[model samples]
Target chain A: METGPIKQKLEQQWQDLSLQLRAIPINPLERKWATIALLIAALFIGIIMIDALVHGINAPSNVETIDSARLHLSEEFAEDNLGVQTDGSGLITVRMVAGRYSFFPKHIDVPAETPVTFRWVSLDVLHGVHIPMTNMSTMIVPGYVAQVTTTFPKPGDYPVLCNEYCGLGHNHMWSNISVIAKEDWAAPVKSAIAGGPENE
Target chain B: MNDAAVRKLALGHLWVAFGAFILACFMGEYQVLERSGLIDALESSSVYFASVSTHGVLMAFVLTTFFIMGFGYYIATTSLKQPLWNQPLAWGGFWVAVAGVVLAAIPLLTGNASVLYTFYPPIQAHVVFYIGATLLIVGSWVWCLIMIVMFSRWKQANPGQPVPLAMFATTANALLWLWTSAGVALEVLFQLIPLALGWIDSIDPGLARTLFAWTLHPIVYFWLIPAYTAFYVFVPKQAGGFLFSDEVARAAFIILVVFGLPIGFHHLYMDPEQAAGWKLLHGFGTFVVSLPTFVTGFTVIASLEIAGRLRGGKGLFGWIGSLPWTNSMVLAVILSLLMLIFGGFGGLVNASYAMNAMVHNTAWVPGHFHLIFAGTTVIMYFAVAYYLWPILLKKPLFSREMALVQLWTWFIGMTILTTPWHILGLLGQPRRISSVVYNNLLTLSWDPYELAMIVGGLVLLGSACLFIYNLAKTQLSPVQDGFVQEIEYAEPLHAVTSLPEYLNDFKLWNKVIAVLMFISFGVPILQFFFIDTFGSSAWGY
Candidate 1:
């Protein structure tokens, strides 16, 4: 493993390089450029934050604490309120409890062209509800009620998947959003009441 | 200085670091293969997670800690022209950290500590694992103390002089790590240990995550400063030119240590405990931190440009072509910067307040970090090892050609591995999944990417092996003629005879960090104790 000639070549190259470098010199970084870069970066990120605000990105900022242990017994998250509920103003609120490996009320039914608020709480660990192809996703952290409001402009089946890892069956944790016509949403409700919840 | 004593100590650390690195590389390949659902025989969730946890710790904690400590020792001694502040204590820290790693490896390997490296509990691991990890941090704290002490002692001896750039940067990392580790130290000592020992019934995940976030982001800078140190201090000399600007390099280090600490809450943007206001503030801080990275890139590239032009290159970008690509250090910097460009873009996307929704918690997160850590940072570590091994061992590199091949393969393999991983995230593939075996259309879409990742992982595994082999051969080979090399610190184009106190010393910056950390984290963390928050019981062992 001898390279006498190669070693000499490298040494010669080094000397030549030093000589060439000494001939022409340039300063790479200027303090003004650094300041400018920082200012521009701050401004760029600021614009994004403003855009986020405008687009209702942080709509879930309204902080509300919840007793995660007794979520099932709580009035807002009771079994009766586990599905869709429509108010007088025709706005629908979908409440669900997100736990390990499942989002309860696996099927969410809503009406198109109507404002809907998806509110949920994690029973254990951190779970995130990310609906593919839409701007609706919020984290379900235990001891806090997570809320995000949006409207389904068009009727479609949107799969709601838990993007965050929550133990073993995380991959299996997914639900379906059944956004139907406004007229269709009314019929299922009326029929359920008339038939007595169990029969329906 | 007793050069032999220092070299022996440094070599011991490097060996351990590389030993951990090689083992983790094997595990990394296994993880990618297992998660890709490419092989049914390798599909055990418990085993896969155990492997991932060990892999993450060995690479992230053990490898980086040992390597940085070793490099810092050699740099502090040679650059300052002084003996190590304390030799026996350095060896003591080494053994204690080794003991911690051994203790932790038991649980990690046996699947008792299958909780991923993040260890965001509710999902608890064995009590021994937490204790072992705590000891590791405590051991590294010893190194941090030595670095600061050495820096101070050198300054006391030589007043108003610019601490050598290498030592200055090393000391900054020491300060950064001391502050960084405190967050997780508090969490582990008070919350995790008690819960794991069954002394407490439950632990608050929010508080735990808040604390980990403090360590999580800056720990990256801790791993990175060494790589940056190499860029500022080694690359220019290796490229056959002087450093572009010493002052710019100093400022970059100052800003990195200052801004790196408080911006960690961005990791908690999707978590529940912290308010959006705090997350937004942290997000802004995250953006501010990018400035130093840009400064580093500009300074290093300009240094290279000068090197190339001096080597008889022409034009604005012709310097790129003229660079000494055959040199391992020069080649690695080019590849590292290339990776940083993409990785840094991914970082900005992650830092974006709203756009984060698109990529948060998905495969994108892993992809982005892999590109940054393993690609940009680890590749430079390889370069540094190649550059330093001969000097440390008093032997010529066994094979320079092999080193070049390894760097190229690492760059190519990282590209193949992470590109598909990022795409899978965009396709809604979640991270930390053991397998994506569902044969649905969406899951099937990930198949090609998964296959690409397997090929990439295998290539990376081969490259990693080559790197270790080359270093081992270099160290074991008999001493050669012309092999006696001394440490060479890059000189700046413009001489720096003196520097301001703030640049030369970290005392003022330390106070600034304290104030910033308190302002950013004080309320968010204290509120956990102040409020009547419920704790979740242990769900996993």
Candidate 2:
């Protein structure tokens, strides 16, 4: 009779365990989490896409148009296009002559908060016009000026180098980009008046 | 050649290649140490870049090419049961190629030819360097011709039969090399030579880049095929298993040859020389090439699975454990494939056009490539050398334990070296830099990783030395094992008999590659000629 109870208990336990197993069914939380993970991934990717779109749309659409103007790079700046004048809030196109780069331009002053269009082409071997401070590096290929544009918010002196291995003295090819503050233009104007005609 | 003659012949070539390799290994260790900025004495930007260039050329071009040629001659004669076609020409190719290496070495050693082993134009090297590189490639071309001729004659004699897998793979590589080298050959012969020689005042760099792109991408496969050959022919047998599929192996080789050539624009994705559309198409082609690799992975794994099962291993993945871990050949594959996974992932990043911009011309590129080429590919070369050395020498290996230790060290060293490289690349370290003279917080952060890389390099150098030492001992060992083992290729799951002409021949794929390459590279390359391009005045010498 005691054996009967043991057998009954074992049968009862087996049934209960079976019911528990049946109740366990497929895990809904794991499935839900998987979907959630996938959605989150999709959403993250979407956010990046939208952000890129907004940035692109807000960017000036001028870059879509290639400047077919024949840009040249000589050893030195063509005497006529030596000086760069920016009219406060517009694009300034600087003509670059590509050849053996010699002169280290200590200060290339650009108006503050202005976009400067670099129309630079190599007159000889490949060189990159690198603005090290801003991390703007563009290839200056032979027969073509790889056109690029960037707006500088802060005005400061930035080192520039020919990033491409152009020749023996590639290490020596260094210049400076002088970003002029908007307020500083008046100082230059005052200096022009104070110091005889502005020397070219 | 008789047994003694064969051993002597192979020994001479092997010694030179390994000797160069060991010397380069020391240089490599120094490079990592210098690059890490830990050793002030090792710090010379000129020396570092020069050493990097020489190390790359010696390991990738010189050692591998010479070894492969010597190995090929042995395999060809033994497997084909025929004498080498045009023996004089073969020797001529060898001598000429060696001369070219010497020519290139002068500039590389002196820091005059530091273009980082790339075909970037107007990066003026000494004229001798360019000429030497050209000669080296031409020498390989000669080998290519000989391999093809011997292959054809063998096939003609034994019609309706499958070529031995090793010979078949070798021939495929020869064909691949012949086709792949043309782009760079043309670029070097015309553009670079003239520039270096002061003959051409200026060249359209876009064209030069486009031409170089043609060679840049596929040459990787040229380096890789021998490793793949070992995988198909040796691994299964070594693991005590059969290859999953013979036909699949053939198909993989054929696909690699066909697809690898047309996908050159992937290298130019960031460059302005090619249009975005072409780069995108090439990106797609790059992904297409991945299919064959996946096929190889599946086929290889399945073969191993079968082997494991045959060894009385049970369960799904449990068969992995059943594999012969002690065997050098089997051990190499596991490590090589592990490297392949990471290297292949990095390759995915490179193929992704947007991400490529993030790491373009960065340290990440070299990190990715070294894993694939040096880690995945060269490790296998070591395994093959171990397996072949004894067979070629007719003696037992001096130390199986040492060989295994070398393999392990190699894998560990590779991980240590390349992990930092990828991190550095992502952290915005540029490739081919002479020095990081400027130090800021960001550059300072790179120090620990560089340190790790140097440690890895030291370990790898030791491993390289150990490998050469073992081979030496094997050759000189007084005890000879009377055991005779033929070259055993793994049999695939499905038996192959009377395979279609496609499997037996490359003629169709050759035609197909010709057409695809034209479509992919034609417009991108031809545009420079058609466009009204302006000429740049001279800059370099």
Candidate 3:
């Protein structure tokens, strides 16, 4: 079979391969291309970092946990407590729950030109909600809360749709968000014990 | 050069892989049609989701696992010039996987396991589905074990010698799979299976997703390394030139294994389970991983250029035209790389931390993956099959022209299908929906794209059938009296006299993988236990 010659040839190939490996760092063309690739990768990371740190555009990663099975019984996510609320500081927040085929508080109203924090939890399975044409999208995983705070600059009616596959009624799972002018919206009365107006 | 047992074993796996692939193609076409709402009668979400679940499992898991196993077997035998390490154990693994597929199909077809392929809990499938899927993974573990054993045995027998590039890549993939599959294995064994079996009353979807995030990203590389192996070892030779650099190819495989595992949180960017810091960290790694693809593109293109120049083609772009277009391997790489360019761009967008919000869970996600996985990866799979079938069967090809046409149509069809899909994502269409029943002006705008996708699906289905037909004909044709061919790996530009151990082995890389995975995933997974969390009851069929 003349195995000696074949083995010698293979041994030569191995040495040449090692030489090429050594040359990679010193070879002008190879070094240049490697540097360019690294720089491009760094540039991408830089853009992402600037977007997160400077531009305030980051992933919706509010790591808040909740008892999803008892979400409806919770104070913030109670059925009657769902939808738009205004705090003492005049900050608007929308609390909602996503179930098999629908978002609780099926319709919502918020003031335009103001930031609204959406706090969503899933009652069962997993769901994702997105308000079309807006940066208001987050996954509603059971056992945790998904929160996204964004300002709707333009006042209009936007469809709040379930983007994640939930169940048989996934496509049917949607609601509406009406972003009204700030002046047109009325804040609900606070109880007198809470030191606020009692208008019905 | 393969023995009868090895040939039978390889063919068995390939047939199953392609069988699953062709079936999944039909389901893909049905999905686009149903989702489009163009056909009124096909409007059942139950049926649609069921089909989608089966489609994803078949194409992503069954087709890939079986095909990789088959291809690994052939590459191990032919390249290493050794008999398969354990013949009966290999067949045992194959049957275990087949049994799993059959078990899972029961639930998938009857709509009991319509949880989609991700099967994220508390959306539960039948207990049998979890068990079946676990069996499939367990079967692949056998293949992994066999590959590692053969690799070590060869190294021991021929000390200080460089392993064949093909076998080296196969062993790398096998090791990567062992690491890659562990995440899902843990998730299934502890979370999904127990929950489905009613042993656990509540399950944390957060922890499930975190574990899946471990497997999710690297598994793509597990699927892709073989295609890259072909690009490195087979394509250059097929194109009639030497490999640009064998050392560079080894480096690429090593980097892919190391960088690929710890960066899965890019899939979890929009999820609440992981913190922003971890997501950003993984996002950085995601971009870093693209370096190998860039190097691959350069090296492969340079090889093709050399081949073209050798064939007397002149000018900068003339090499592209002078490539052996009739050769299925050459034609497939050309098309595969073209798809990789576009798909890679889409992947970068998905990996972008803030930018992902625009396309997260949208049709764009599917579009990006289909282009990369189905278009780029599977196209290479076609080339490898076309290249291997005649050698395995000792017969001539049924139709070279038909194979070329199939490759072109696959590229064209994939482009047509995915372009509008990406557009639909930008237009704010959520993926995995059975029907678009919104009926608004915005929804109506998606109609033309949907129509285009239907045409694309039809073209892809026909192309798939042609691929199978050519291979089947090749196999069934009577063996030639004097058919003689040997698998040829591309030689490097210069012969080597010696090499370092790091480039020739995976022991160090495996350690590096462990450290990287721990650093990236340790706190994220551990936090589930430390934090106050709730688990949800089972919710779906």
Which candidate leads in TM-score?
Answer: 3
- Cα TM-score per model: 0.93, 0.81, 0.95
Off by over 4 Å in 2: A1-139, A148-200, B2-12, B479-485, B534-541
Task: Compare candidates 1 and 3 on TM-score and give the better one.
Answer: 3
Local distance difference test, per candidate? 0.86, 0.72, 0.89
Identify the superior model by TM-score, candidate 2 or candidate 3: 3
Q: In terms of DockQ, which candidate is strongest?
A: 3
Q: After superposition, how far is residue A189 of candidate 3 from its true place, in Å?
A: 4.6
lDDT for each residue of candidate 1 in B1-541, tens digit (9 for 90 to 100):
3999999989999999999999999999998888877778988887888898899999999999999999999999999999998899999999999999998999999999987788868778899999899888888989999999999899999988889999999999999999999999998999889999999988877788899999999999999999999999999999999899888798889999999999997787766678888888888889889999999998998899889999999987898898999999999999999999999999988888777877778888999999999999999999999998998999988999999999999999999999999999888787877887433456768889998999899999999999999999988887787768888989998998876576688987899999999999999989887877878888773
**Chain B TM-score for all candidates, comma-separated:** 0.99, 0.96, 0.99
The CAPRI classification for model 3 reads as acceptable
Docking class of 2: incorrect
Error of 3 at B18 (Å): 0.1
Candidate 3 chain B, which ten residues in sequence have the lowest lDDT sum? B493-502
Which residue runs of candidate 1 sit more than 4 Å off their true CA positions?
A: A1-29, A52-56, A112-114, A152-155, A181-200, B437-440
TM-score of 3: 0.95
Scanning candidate 2 chain B in windows of ten residues, the lowest lDDT window is: B532-541
RMSD of 2: 13.2
